[model samples]
Target: MLYKLNLEHILFLDIETVPQRPSFADLDENSQMLWEQKSQYQRKNEITAEDFYERAGIWAEFGKVVCISVGYFTLKDNERNFRVTSFSGEETRLLKQFKQLLQEHFNLAKHLLCAHNGKEFDFPYIARRMVINGMNLPYKLDLFGKKPWDVPHLDTMELWKFGDYKHYTSLKLLAHVLGIPSPKEDMDGSMVKDVYYNENNLDRIVSYCELDVITTAQVFLKLRNEELLGRDEIKKV
Candidate 1:
């Protein structure tokens, strides 16, 4: 009998976003003043979109996803292999692709979707983008009003809280603690916006997004073994 996890059903995703460009006509006097102050600060500190994403809480409005990367992992022969895919284009196109991928490979009842800070950010961001694109959401993503533990959704950041909510842990920090090699150490999320703007390099954004999914998967494995299994040992299959 095979005891492998159904990798085809698991989706790990991450996104990169940039601020919405404000129109001159749309800006009120107060808004213009605020924009000027923000512009000056951005120039002074050399802040990039990714920096704003991680630190400024701007994804609420100014942010628009420039890239979304997904990784699907499965166990074969007691080892994990991942199939990665990414979309870098308009939000509508990327979201449509994401929806199609979900429909083609995963069944809502059997598969799980995982992320790092998905509950608070990634999931909602994706959901809103889909709606904005006039796309119907997949069944698995319809977790509104569902309890966190009841859904087939796993967020490694939430898991790392370990029942104490006082401190927040980043994916990079969790990966380090779990002995997983940090893929984004050379490039933080803050650099993503500039990379997209200056270099017009979609590949860089995709790579960053994929790295996040990979790191999130690693953290999930660690948390599953430690918190759920109550043991440090994990059988790959």
Candidate 2:
């Protein structure tokens, strides 16, 4: 079934996020209390909410998307090329740009938005952020009354699970196991917060996010028993 689907119909993507504030103290008193409650079980009694604040980006309520990088395959003259692009800058602005891309290009019933763990993370995260930014949910991200099979989103992690709900797979680990090039050469997700807040290197973070998008597309091709994309075939636009 995977091989039968048209690769061009998919828009592969990944997103990078950072906490809304640089530190817990940066948050208002009400926000700090909310953070404490939100992270109680995850941190347990061992770590303070302030200490766990670095991971706030994992929750949409506490984080803002710093970048959303996307890639898609285009076949010309029997040769395939992958075009990649990114939306970055102020959270609201970038989210709007991304929403426009979805509405304009990938809005068809047959089009799909593919990500490594999108259904659980990227897709919902983007939706939640859009709402927070006071934007309408694009058709692709709006899951209100849609039934399971009717939705046009693809999750590579979910595909890898194959009915094993208890299993979890990170994109880096999956790429390694699948014999695709690693996207975490320079840094990993854990380092994103520090890179964005401390180092102030959004370009570096954007590069990292784009790499993940490319790697995701490669992983999808591998899953379908298709040939992997060559570096020359990938163009960042």
Candidate 3:
């Protein structure tokens, strides 16, 4: 029997990134100007440039993904079993591996790729990197032109909106309200760039990515169980 909807085809993924540097002295003038502006703002706020740099780095580093972790889970005889894997080699190699896994094990046309904010962040990031590497994006990501609900993609953050569409709720906050264990209490996305850059540790990055996936999966499960809403409400699949 088929388990939960698209249970066998569900893949939860997350990535970590670090800023690209130009040997300090060779940093471009445009970058220097932007840093100076940020430094002035930091001074007004009583924060150091190092602090601002780390906060601003997530986007710059987003263009330089250092690690991607994907978690696959399926229900077997009423129990859910999950396998978490990390792809942490060069960016090109990791992107290739991700494609290979999708081709070999998943049907892009049928599988549901669930993410926290994938529609806005993860999916586009992966697609752009794949294109840069001359890799063909999987068919499932072809829903760029389709309506949000018409496609198989699901973003938990969007679901949390529940048609209100007011304030944006964070994954950590949702987990707290829903009683799911917070996975990365030890580290937030803000520190990912530093963890990879300063420590040169891929394992820490992998751990952070994996924890995000796990938290996402937990949120999905909560939605599936009807534990996140009122009885008269219909859950969005």
Model 2 lDDT per residue over 93-157, tens place: 99999999998999999999999999999999999999998999999999889999999999999
Per-candidate clashes come to 4, 0, 0
lDDT of 3 by residue, 136-182 (tens): 78876656677766676778887788877675888888888989856
Encode model 1's per-residue lDDT on 10-60: one tens digit a residue: 788888886544232344566446555665555446764333333322343
The Cα error of candidate 3 at residue 208, in Å, is: 1.5
Query: Candidate 2: where is the Cα deviation over 4 Å?
Result: none
Clashes of 1: 4
Top TM-score hit? 2
Poorest stretch of ten by lDDT in candidate 3? 228-237
lDDT of each: 0.66, 0.94, 0.68
Error of 3 at 82 (Å): 1.7
Q: After superposition, how far is residue 8 of candidate 3 from its true place, in Å?
A: 1.8
RMSD after CA superposition, every candidate: 6.8, 0.9, 6.6
Rank candidates, lDDT, best first: 2, 3, 1
